[model samples]
Target: MSDSSINLDELRQRIDQLDGDILRLISERAACAQKVAHVKLAHDKDAVFYRPEREAQVLRRIMSLNEGPLDSEEMARLFREIMSACLALEQPIKVAYLGPEGTFTQQAALKHFGESAISLPMAAIDEVFREVEAGAVNYGVVPVENSTEGVVNHTLDTFMDSSIHICGEVVLRIHHHLLISDTTRRDKISRIYSHPQSFGQCRKWLDAHYPHAERVPVSSNAEAAKLVKTEWHSAAIAGDMAAKLYGLERVADKIEDRPDNSTRFLIIGSHQVPMAGEDKTSIVVAMRNQPGALHDLLEPFHRHKIDLTRIETRPSRTGVWNYVFFIDFKGHVDEPRVAAVLDEVRLRASELRVLGSYPQGVL
Candidate 1:
């Protein structure tokens, strides 16, 4: 064999040896973690199997120990699975997402839960919260904000009365596409259907191309895709997944106003999530409509060096146009700095509700 070929073979052999060693080490580590779970349970008299603190420590240690030819982010993600598996050795997780399946919420659900979860799809945002509240699901995924348009009002409003806490979050890139039935006639298109959100995301593209086509709003992107199947003259604006799931052909893709348009989703559950060094908290504060009310509510956060990630105004629902500002910020609610900010804000606002504190969503 050529010298270079012989060298390649030797490298492959080494990689195979390393892979086996890594697997063996992971299995041993899992056994050790399970033992830790038992010890924690005995001491705490609660479920010690899922220690968010230990999970965070494991991930941080993995990053610290990594001398990676692989990216640190990639290494951490792989280790997240290891911790997830170890945790599951103690308990398997059940997650809920907003969907009829093929919805963006499902994408966020997968991102948050990894592959080791039982994911249930719900028909409405409130239904997702209901499932979590009812203990029918362990975690619920729902949209909270969109970069292009604004907050998902339904999700924010659900927060108004719901008692379920936000446990984690995920952000998903929103992509819009124009899809049609296989038999659709390109020249005879009359009306288009999509969820209002999807239509809003693709508004500029639609106006410039199909200025005369009637735009109709449906309950969801999937429903719009389903509508197109019954009528050959109508096309649906949805994501690639919807098109694929409905067996529709895409005539247009990436049609959103901007390429970076994305939505932030929240994972809601009953438990208060432990601090994962990098975390975020969401709170809803209702202030009496006074001049500089927002400033007064935000002042404490600024003083505490808490970073505000999002702020959206919604009708207070107690009265029309008496708006409440929904604010999301960095740092877990359990942290001292964040707790202080909330305490101060609570004193200033008429009403203060902690939506939840959770780990910041990663792409």
Candidate 2:
């Protein structure tokens, strides 16, 4: 046999041995996870099987300890799947996301919970909240903001009426592609379908290429992809999952105007997550319609040196001219400074609600 062939055969044999070791280790981890479930159940009848903070800490540690040809994120993702699978053996988790099956929110849900999770698709953001609130699902995933399009106001508005708490968050880099079905006539395409935000994201690209094509706004990019499956003269602007789900081909990839386009999704549940070293807190503040009300509300955070991540204003459902400010900031509420800041803000504001203090997104 050739030396190269012998070397390749030996490498293959080594890989086979490593695979066996990996499988055995994974099995042992699964058994350990099962034992953990038994212990928790023995201690408390209604013990929560999932811990967002714990999972976040594990993934973060995996990322920090990783030193490999594969990047930290890639390594962490592998560990995430393993953890997810082991957790399923302990107790399967059901999650709901804003969807009709194939949307960015669904992708975010899978990314956060892993494929082992049972994911249900709800037609609206509020429905996702309802499912989680009703105990029909363990958690829910909904879009909070887009890098290009700003906040999803519907999501924010839904939060104002709901009692759901944020457990964790996941950020997905969005890459919209111009996709078509097998029957689509690329040259003869006269109509395009997409969510309004998607059209806005790919506006420049569409204007430069298919200016005359009628831009039809739909409920979601998934719906747009579904529509293109039957229309030969139509194309859809959507992400990879939708295209793959609908069996559509990408005519133009990554057509979003900005290369750095991304969206942040929130994981909502009933329980408050514990701190995982790095954390973020979300609160809604309703200030009386008066001069310097905003200033009064923000002064405490400034004084405490708390890093504010985002601040969004929505018209309050209460009295006229009243507004509610959705604020996101660094630090968990359990911390002294953060608690003090909240106490000060509460004194200045007409109404304030700390939605949640959760671990910042690790992946």
Candidate 3:
């Protein structure tokens, strides 16, 4: 029998009771987190820390175990916010990202900490790194690479000198939309604005649709969206969030050249997170550019049975003729095998920098 066939008052009472139980459980979970913080502090340990591997595993587990209409991402976000609040209660953390406000990095900051943590916006990527380095922000988010456009060289080059660790990684699905100010006159747009990545991703689409429009590069998509609202002859290629925030008209949706285009962002912090099953370790290795040097360094991983995920070469800042290979693999430094691989790599390379490892973001 359904609620309509039963006594309405009794059915309402049952739902109310269920809600009470849910509230009680939420309270219990929060209390337990506080206790965990207390226990860690008692042991003279750091209570507040970001564990990317743990987060990735948690979200993945939640997705695997999901049995409802809410979807895995929905459930993961709900729990993520709760964990963020609990950690903030233990100790509030401040994060800095490239922004004036309402930027994609800000969205990344929210993804990392939910609504509980505070976020500070810096004008440039270097500033984001500097703020984190200076202890002005506990963490920072910056785009490392795009699926379509390749690696962000600035971020890669910045790592050569900074001591920040890569605590997590978030892969964001990117969608570009053409937003126009309502006041825009004439169907012929004189200018288009967006972040360079957005512009590049949507290049073909724009070339075909609006060949004569002046494509202008801006610092961020949000800034581009803001600019469109003020310029009657201009349109912005930005995400849904930017379009909505600026109250611009979404003339076209998913206007990027490819649907699978995504950006990989890195979470930079000062501590190494413990392994939580699935994790990624990033490190920069400088080896002799000789025939067997690369082979020697990579052979140890195969010997140790480690799965290397990504390997990229960047010109070494020490000299124009030299280069460093940055690698990402699916294992934590704490694992004996992983540790052994690193030890072996250290002996083979002239210089090695562990970029730190953390749980991967499931998104």
Candidate 4:
């Protein structure tokens, strides 16, 4: 045999052996998870199948221990799926996301919960919050902010009236593609469909290229992708999942004006999550309408030297709400420094509500 042929044969043999070994290990892990399920069932009839803090710790450890040809994030994703399957052996988790199916929120849901999870799509952000609040689903995922477009106000506004807690977070890097169905007239495209935020992110690009095209804002990129499937003169701006789900072709890829466009999605549930070492706490403070109200609200955080990730102000929904500040900061609520800051803020604010402290996004 030729030298190259011999090397190829050996490599194939080695890969086959490794595949078998991996299969065995995965089966063993699933078996162990099943054993865990039985033990929990014996102790508590309503044992939660998933633990946000525990999952975060595992993913972080996987990334930390990785010294691989595969990137840390990539390796962590593989383990994510593995864990998801094992968790299904314990119990399948039902999650709701804002969507008509095939939206970026759905992608974030799948990424965080894995394919083994049962993900349901809701029409709006409030619906996602409502689902978890009603106990219709075990958890919900909703977009909180986009790197290119700032905060999602609707999500923040929902927190003011809802009791659902933030249990975890997931960040999805967005890459918008101009997609068209097989029957779409590429040359006759006069209208482009996409979510408003997707259009906003790609404004410069749109103006430079298809400036004359009518930009129509829809409920979601998935809905946009769905609409174009029957329209001959329209193209949809959406992501890869939508494109595949609807059998569309990419007319242009990664057309977002910002290359690093990403959206942060929060996991909402009925229960508060314990600290996962690295954590973030979200709170809404209704400030008294007075001088230095803004400054007074932030002073405690600065004094404690706590890292603030984001701060957004929304018009209060209640009669008492003149201005409500939504704050996200580093450190779990259980920590002394965070507790001290909250105590100070509580004294200054008319009202305060801790949304939930959750593990920081790991993958």
In model 4, where do residues sit more than 4 Å from their true spots?
319-321
Candidate 4 RMSD computed on C-alpha atoms after optimal superposition onto the true structure: 1.3
Per-residue CA lDDT of model 1 for 1-363, tens digit only, reads 899999999999999999999999999988997787788777887563544444555666777888979877688778777767776776677888888777778767766666676788888999998998998877889998888988888998998989999877677889888899988898889999988888888888999999999999988888889899999799999887788889999888889998999988887888887887888888888998889988898888888888898888888888877988888899987788788888898889999998877666544
> In model 3, what lDDT does residue 87 have?
75
Q: Compose the digit string of candidate 4's lDDT tens values, residues 1-363.
A: 999999999999999999999999999999999999999999999998799999999999999999999999999999999999999989999999999999999999999999999999999999988889888999999999999998998999888888889999999999999999999999999999999999999999999989999999999999999999999999999999999999999999999998999999999999988889999999989988999999999988888899999889899876665889899999999998899999999999999999999999998
Model 3, 134-247: lDDT tens digits are 988889999999999989888988999898898888888888899898898758688999998888999999999999999899999999988987788999998877877889
- RMSD each, Å: 2.9, 0.9, 2.5, 1.3
Using TM-score as the measure, name the better of candidate 1 and candidate 4. 4
Off by over 4 Å in 2: none
Tell me the lDDT of candidate 2. 0.94
| Model 1 C-alpha lDDT versus the unseen true structure | 0.83
Tell me the TM-score of each prediction against the true structure.
0.87, 0.98, 0.91, 0.97
